[model samples]
Target: MSGEPLKKAQESAAESPRALRDLIGYHLKRASAWDLHNANAALEAAGVRTVPMSVLLTITEKPGISSAEICRILRMQRANIVPVLAELEARGLFLREADPDDNRIQRLFPTAKGREEAQRMLGLISAHEERMLAGLTMAERDELRRMLAIIWREDGEG
Candidate 1:
């Protein structure tokens, strides 16, 4: 390539606006990545990752919630949830029992240990989120969360 063409290419690349940063989707994904990294680091002491943290919180909040219900609420597939349930159960954090009304349906119940872990994880998560949004004022953070909820509040239209 000619030096002139190479120079023009580099100049254009350098001068181009960061349009991706202006995009809502781009910022959401990037922020999510940063949250994941920080949350994982903070939760490492608990031996739990983000998904498990969510699942544990859910289970603790709604005891007797079924794995299927968890799938719907978490927007996760059964295949992904099953392993997490297994891991939590093996750790004695929670247990599944056959539903009284339907023998086939298994309900999740967080044990005493699971509730304690959930409380601890929540504290860690709260700290991590506060740190992540430390630059934002309280009102801005509240508004950001409210706006984010509205974006995901409804089912997608076909």
Candidate 2:
């Protein structure tokens, strides 16, 4: 085959759907892993080592948010959140109480220490998020967020 035809064939192969999806997936996964690593490092630098991402997310959002609410928002299984909640409770970072409105429900409330730690962790997380989103313009970032939300909705996650 001539060099020109070989080049054309290679170009077409690169544009194939499977190849495109693989490329997209590779970059997406890499970015996600890097973000997670950086976030963990940031949290550690802020003197937090044992807190999981879910716990941080929950605590940062509301001081006395319920565990059931966390599970629902995070789409996490109840069993998966239980051990983390137990650990956080044991550390005296938070307390769980039976909801007065519904005895079957458990409510989560951070202790004073937990609130302080959560504030520090939130600062670290904000810094990390700023770094992660540094390059994109505000409009571009908004668009990207919108697109991701669409994907999540399609997957029944939003």
Candidate 3:
């Protein structure tokens, strides 16, 4: 094979299906990647990663909630959430205790430090979101959330 042909192929852009960019899945994946990158940066200052931030916030909002509920609400696996919960606990951000009514289950709650940290972290995250949605009006943002909720509802039905 001629080196010229090989070089041209190597320089070519990724070959994907036509209209890929127009697809909702493609846009969703790209938007998620961008948001994750920006969110992670803000999360780092709080001494935690994305998952831990989520866990902390959930605990703050629903104190004494069980780990099983957190897993269900986040649509995450036990194996994944276990480590994140451990990290948060180790950092003194939250605590886990055996449920009083159900001794078999463990409940999570944020400590005083956890609540303060979560408030700061949430502010940073909110700023990042505002920048990402800068082009959208308040009405548009509300409509977008409503549309996303519909998809999420269908997800549970399936």
TM-score of each: 0.85, 0.71, 0.83
**Candidate 3: minimum summed lDDT over ten consecutive residues — where?**
5-14
Q: Candidate 3: which stretches are off by over 4 Å? A: 1-17, 155-158
Question: Could you give the candidate ranking by TM-score, starting with the highest?
Answer: 1, 3, 2
State the C-alpha lDDT per candidate.
0.87, 0.72, 0.81
Model 1 accuracy (lDDT, Cα): 0.87
Task: Predict model 3's lDDT versus the native.
Answer: 0.81
Total clashes in model 3, counting residue pairs 3 or more apart in sequence or in different chains? 0
Highest-scoring model, lDDT: 1
For each of the candidates, give the backbone clash count.
0, 0, 0
Candidate 3, 5-118: lDDT as tens digits: 445433431354558745778757766888999999877777666788888899999999888899888888988988888788888998878988889998888999999999
Clash pairs (backbone) in predicted model 2 = none
The C-alpha RMSD of each candidate to the native structure, in angstroms, is 8.6, 7.8, 8.6
Model 1: colliding residue pairs:
none
- C-alpha displacement of 136 in model 3, angstroms? 0.9
